[model samples]
Structure formats: structure tokens, C-alpha cells
Target: MDLREKERKTVEILRALKKVNYPGYSRDIVSFGFLKKIEVYDDDRVFIDLEISTQKEEVIEQIKEKVQEEIGKIGWIKGLELSVREREIFRRQKIPIKGKTVAIYSTKGGVGKSSIATQLAYTFSVLGLKSSLLDLDVYGPSIPKMTGTQDSEPTSYDGQHIIPVEKEGVRIMSLGYMAKGDTPVIWRGPLVIKAFRTLIFSTHWPDTDVLVIDLPPGSGDIQLSLAQEVNIDGIVMVTTPQDIALEDVRRGISMYRKLEVPILGIVENMSWFTCDSCGKKHFIFGKGGGELLSKVYNMELLGQIPFDYELLELADRGKIYVLEKKNSEVAQAFLSIAKKIIDLLKISV
Candidate 1:
């Protein structure tokens, strides 16, 4: 390899980082003790994790811009991922939910992420446990449609605390419930952040055994903000049994790990399809992506959920799949995963 194309070391990155000063501050972010990690891994890529003591958007962006520009100066840098986790400027009030919070996350969308989250919450309820589901997928809030709560609006007698809609013993809340019948949420970043804060702080979440949050797709402001604000017990990573989906899952895992968020396990969705007539399991989206990730990351292979062709129609029509076919292989996959989650997190159910 050419000398210029040689892999950069942590010390080398640190040397380059000395030039990056915090926004409106003379001292470098490293000297100010904001740099938490500088990892150079996988194909000469760099993962920089910064933990700052401010929530100001402009400051964060300024630091980000300056750092990226400085890091780009390294000619051989094949890839760069920078995560800036901002601390709450003020000691804010915690959300009303009690007990453990198990977040379901995916960096890429349409991996049946939301569906898995819904079924997990439902399964918790079926096991005679108080369960709540929070849909943090702001841009595409599918919880209301999945739970058959679109016609209902959240109500609050006290005006300060909003009541979550209940269905099949599971308490639920989503931005979709506020929209006017299938309307899209088209807000910009600042407003989207505010909306996330409002839902978490405003809702009068009842005491429950566990709360499952369907995090918005991506390792962005939403995920960072929630991690900084809420006490997430652990996260269940959802991904399809395909390379495309697995790539995004890796990035998401890195972000959560940097935030010190516990990874409960991984759920491989649409892993296979069982042909009714042939009675054979066919791998629709390639095989063993989930197991590969689990082995690589040392995370448990929670379960591989099969593709039930009927699930698309059932979920679209607001019918719970687990409840519809309790004896089904797919349904069993969901229930089995739920049990593992409770056991892993040690949540009372």
C-alpha cells in the first residue's frame, strides 16, 4: 500500500483533532474533555464519539463541522462516523413511565421494525403484564394504524399530562394519533426534536412492567436525544436477513454503544417463509445475517422471525398477528423473542 493510503492510528487522529476548537470557545474540545472515544476499526474507518456538556444545536453543529473538516484532512481516511452526544442543558423532568424501557431500533426503514415492536408490546400484555408502546418514529408513525387507534385522540383531564390510548391491555401513544387521518409529519429538525421531547415528557405514562419504544429509523438527533434524556434499560435491534439491512444495523449498534445504551439482543425479521403446500422453509432474504451479526457483536440471537405473507394484510388492517395466529411459527417467533427480552432485562412480567 502507498504511504499516504496507510491506515490512520488513534494517536494520528488525536494529533489532527488538536486543531478543532469548540464553537465560540478558544479551547479545543479534546482539552475540554468532550472526546470520549476515538476508534479506528474495520477497513481503516474511524468512529469518533464526543460527549459535550451543552444542548445548543448551533454549538453541536459547529463542533461537528469543524471536526469533520479537520478529520477529512487525513488523506487516507476511507470512512468517518462522528457521534456528538449533547447533555441536557438543564436538569429536565424525567418521563412518567415506570420500570424498564426496551427500545426497538433500526437505522433503515421498512424492515418490519414497527411490526416487531407492536407484537412485542402485545405479547407482554398477553403474559398478564402492564405494557406500554411509544412510537418515536416521527416521520412515519405507524403505531396508531397498527394498533387501530387512528380514530382516537389523546385526552387529558389535568391538561398537563396527556393520556395514552389503550388497546388489548397495552397503553400506546404516537404522533399518528394527532394527525388528521393518514396525514404525514413534515416538520423540520428543530420542530421534530421538540415533538419528541413533548411526547416523552407530556404523556402520563402509567406504571408498567415494561415500555417498548419504536425508535425512528437512523442514528440521528432523535436517538441521541432520547438516550441522553431517558433511562433505556436495553435495546432490541431489528433487521432483515439481508446484507443491505445488516449494514445499517451495524451503524445503529455503534451509536447506541457509544451512548452506553445496553444492547439486549437482535431480532432478525423476515428470515424465512414456510410454504404451506410444500412444508419447506425457504430463505427469502438470504440466510444467517442475524446470526452473523450476533456472533460478530457478541449479542444474543434473540430470534429469527419468519415472513408470514398474511401478516402484511393483517397488520395493514390493524389486526394483531400474534393474537390472530397464536399457534403460528411467526407468532411463536415474536412471543419467544418477548420472553427472551424479559429474561435478559430481568423485567417483572
Candidate 2:
């Protein structure tokens, strides 16, 4: 390639990276201002330099993979080299809360993770331990709706620090409280992390024993970012009694384990249904997926919640299911799991 041709080729290669998005965001890496320089060599080879604010190793690899995939399609290129420099995004800070953080996480969605989290926090409160629930799922924060605090916005005494909204004796905070009903959060990964900083690092949570974080379903950027920034003391894997959910939970377990977060065990939601006439237990999703996962991973199965339609009704009315049905089987299951989590987290009431 001649000098002028090389310059044009360098521009082409650099422009090509616009298709390569950051690991878990819709925005391209080029727009993220990560592409520092590109050099097209005489032998139809190219070298690209990227400086990104993410410190995650897997994310770095993902960006490189995407860049290579996008740049490798050109027939004229003989080779491609990429270098990604991890720029420090921000200094690590404490969550400004005194508690053991227990995250309710899943690799799959719609398994009642938020319901369980809200119930768990209530259980802790019932057990006489001050509990706080931070609904960290910015995309679809269901805590406000479940707790019936959707209309109440958290008060920020200072512009930088927000005071959390309290409900059912459990201090609560979520982005859902501010947004209108079912409004989608259309933010990129960095914006999501910025929300985390504001909600977590900037919010003023009352002194409590347990902070239940209802994480959105997945092992993606949101999960990874929180794990990296906050000291997640334990994680409770939630899943339905099905192969697919168990499979997702398996991947979630691996991710948390890699992050060195303690696994508090698993909760099997919608495990079974009771026959009205025969009174026989019928496995709805599947029997013993939680138990099977426990045995396979050598992780304890915390509790299995039966298919409770009333619980759904309770949530829809913004009522705490455990408080409403304290004597119900599903309520007892939630309490059981909460007790196990308390013991696992070593939270003294």
C-alpha cells in the first residue's frame, strides 16, 4: 500500500470499529471515545489502539473480540492487532450503608426474583433486624410497585445524597419510584453504572443489618459492574424449577464465584402446585431442579416456594405477601430462606 493509500486505509480501519460496540452496551466503542489510534501497515496489516474506562477483564476481551470480528471481514487485510488500555473510571467508594449486602440474582428473567427479594427484606424486618432493600435493577425496578411506594420519590436533603423511601419497616430505594408507570430505562452501560453510583454510593441508607439488592436477571454489564464496585457479601441464586432456569442459574453461580462473592444458596420459586380435591403436590415447572443444582454444585438449596397465585395478587396490590399470609406455605418458605440467608450472611439481629 502507498503512503496516501495507507492513510486512507487507516481511516477505513478506524471507521470500521464504529460497528464494534462495548461489551454490553448499544453504543459503539468509537463513540465511547475508546479508539485512540489506528495504523495501516505496508503489508496490508493493521494495528488499533483503544483506551476504555472499564476495568473488567472479560469486558476487555469482549471489546477486542468484537473489534477483531468487525475488522477481519476486509479481504485486503492480512493481519489485525488490537490493544485496549483500561482507564480508571472512578475511585472506589463505600455504599454509605452499614449492612451485609445480599443480592437476589438470576441468569434468566421472570422467575419472581423481585418478589422474593422484597419478601426476604420484610422477613428480616419481622425477625427484628433493621433491613434495607435497594432495588438496583435500573431497567425494570419492580420494588416500588411491589412495596406500593411507586408514587413516592426519595428525598435528597443534599443535591448529591438521596434519602431512601421506607415501606413496611424496610428502607427502600429504586429508580422506579421516580419514573412513571412501566417506563423503560433506555440507558447505556456507563449510564447504568452512573445510576448505581447515585443510588448506591450517593444515597443515604439508614443503619441496617441486611441490604437486599434485587438485581436484574442476567450476568451482564450491570451485574459485573455492581460486583466490582460494591462489596457484595453474598448472593442468593433464584430460579424456577426448570432445566432452562437451572442452566441460567448455573452460569450465574460461576460468575459470582469468579467475582469471589459468597453463594448463600438457591431458592426455587413456583416449585409445585397443590391439587384442590386430591391435595397432592404436583411439580409444575419440574421436580427437584433446585435440589439437583444444589447437589451438582454442592451448594445448599435454601427453600422451594410453591406456586402461590395469592402471592401474585399480593404483589399486584403492593402488599407484602409474607406479612399478609404469614401462615401460608409460600410465606413460610420465604421466611425459611431468609433465615438461611441471615445465618449465611452472619447478620445478628
Candidate 3:
């Protein structure tokens, strides 16, 4: 109602609006310099001017609707006027990466997707190829801890481009680096999407031959957002041998199929457990789930990784077992998967 109060509320509104991210773009409206001006009056009236780069009427309307929706949440605002202008210069720009990107996804959690992603990156490095791993699990980023860079944060120059942290001969980026120790990222969908985009496009990734992204389990906003933005080469679906896990994998495969992105193959993680005492293999989860899915979908069964306690121990210590225990069966399985992926993509490694 008062002048100062109105100004404060107007500023708050702008901040909130800045947090709204367009699905396909890598930056929010504010970061893209689309939100041009805002004015607040003492009579609880507000006006906003937005300039977007796209010529599509639907996109412009969507932006307006989102703005109005956000503003409507503040009941104190009595009246509002909004204007959106289109400028070709304001359009989203794609950041070119000189590498094939492979997203490792699962429809459900607790499938060791992150561990497999980290190991695959390490495997690529071991075979003398440039590799990078990006942790796009916005709510549960683990690449920082998995790669022994948990105490570090990515460095940015000129406050725009970020320098990725390197470890074990692989470049790494993760939201975990941005958070304080063990603090959960309590972000909404829009914020999560924006952060994912920033991590993918804003970071200064090296000339990697392959960039493996560890996506959070599920077919949620992150997966959809990624489909819209990046030209992903292929997807490597990870699942346990249990029927429950395989069911989720089917949904994941269907989602990618609808998106028209290639499903590189399926990796059957924890396919079995080997007894140390008797040297016997046991199908703990089930048998041939990966093979079943691969056959049904006509995709290759990249590798079958048996369950191993030593692999878990190395991962717990933020180490890549592929490098330390290169001779181990689990490590060898990862290498085989990596080679198959490289071959599928036709990348020289």
C-alpha cells in the first residue's frame, strides 16, 4: 500500500519471476535478459515488459500465462498489465559440445545408475579417450562425492562460464558441488530445470569424446527438459534383474521411444552375486531381465555386471574402482559396456 512496501513487493515479484525457466532454453527469462522492465504503483497496480526471441505465438502466450500465474499467487496485487515483445536476438542459443552425450536413466531409484555412470566415464578415460561426467540429478547430485570432489565447487570466470572439476582423468560437474555439506536441495520443478540447464550449458566442459550424464531416476521434469534442450546421441538404461525394476525400465524405454531418441542398450546391473568362499554365481535379483528387455526392444545387452562388495566399498570412498581394480570382474564389465557404447556411437576411442 505504501511506496516503500510497494517497491519491496515489486522487487520480490521480479525475483520470483526470474526463477521461472522456459523448458527448452538453458537460462531463465531474467538470465536471458528477456524481462525488460517492471513498474509498481502505490495503488497496488503493476506493469511488466518482457522481450523474448522466439517468433512462435504459442511460446509467447505460454510465457505470458506463466507470468500471470506467478503474479496471481500474490493476492495483494490488485491489477496487472503485461507486455511481451519478440526479438530475434533474444532467442535461445545452443552451446556446442564436441562430444557425444549419453544419458544414463532409470525409471526407479536405487538402481546404482550414478555408480555405473561414474565407472563408465572412468572406463572411457582408461581406454585413452577424453570423457566427462555430469550429475544432472538436481535433487540428489552424487557425482561430486563419487568422484572425490565433494569438498570442491566449480570455478567460474567473468561470472558466467564455469570450469568443471577434474578427477581421475575425467572432467566432472554436479549440483552437489554447489550445496553445503549434506544439505538437501529443496527446489521446485522450475528451479531444478534451470539448475540442470546451467550445469549442462554454462559449464566449460573440455573437448570430451563422450559425456555421460547421470540423470535422477524416473521419467520426470528433468528427463523431459533434457529431451527438449540437448541433442542426446543415445540413452543407456540401467536396471536391476528384478521384474519390478524391469517394469520401470520398460516405461523408461517407451518414453525415450516417444521422444525418438535412440536407446543405445540396456545394462543389467547387479545381475547376480558371486560368492567369495565357493566361487559360485547366484542370481540374487532374477535371471535374464536385461536379456529379456533387450530382446523385446531389439536393443543390445551391453553388459551384465555382477554384484560385488568391493565395488561398493570403493564407491563409498569416492573412488572409481575401474582404475584401482582394473583386473576385477566388475571393473571388466564396466569396460566392456563402455566399449560397446563407443562402438554403438561410432566414436573413435
Candidate of highest TM-score: 1
The local distance difference test score of each candidate is: 0.83, 0.82, 0.82
Candidate 2: count the clashes. 0
lDDT of 3 by residue, 1-349 (tens): 5557766987888877876777477667888888766766556667677878888998888888888888888888889878776763323334457878899988879888999999999999999999999999988888787777898778988799889898968989888888756777878888998998899888897588889999998998999778756788989988788875544665676566655578899898999998999999999889887887776556888999999988888888987889999998898899899989989999996
TM-score each candidate. 0.77, 0.73, 0.72
What's the count of clashing pairs in each model shown?
0, 0, 0
Compared with the true structure, the alpha-carbon lDDT of candidate 2 equals 0.82
Cα lDDT, model 2, residue 130: 90
lDDT of 1 by residue, 117-203 (tens): 899999888887798999998888998888778788899989888898988888898988886555678777898899898788887
Worst 10 residues of 1 by lDDT: 1-10
Regarding TM-score, does 1 or 3 come out ahead? 1
lDDT of 2 by residue, 179-257 (tens): 6666678677788888877788766875878888998889877888877787888888887888864446656765666
Full candidate order by TM-score, most accurate first: 1, 2, 3
Which runs of model 3 end up more than 4 angstroms from their true locations?
1-95, 245-247
Off by over 4 Å in 1: 1-93, 245-247
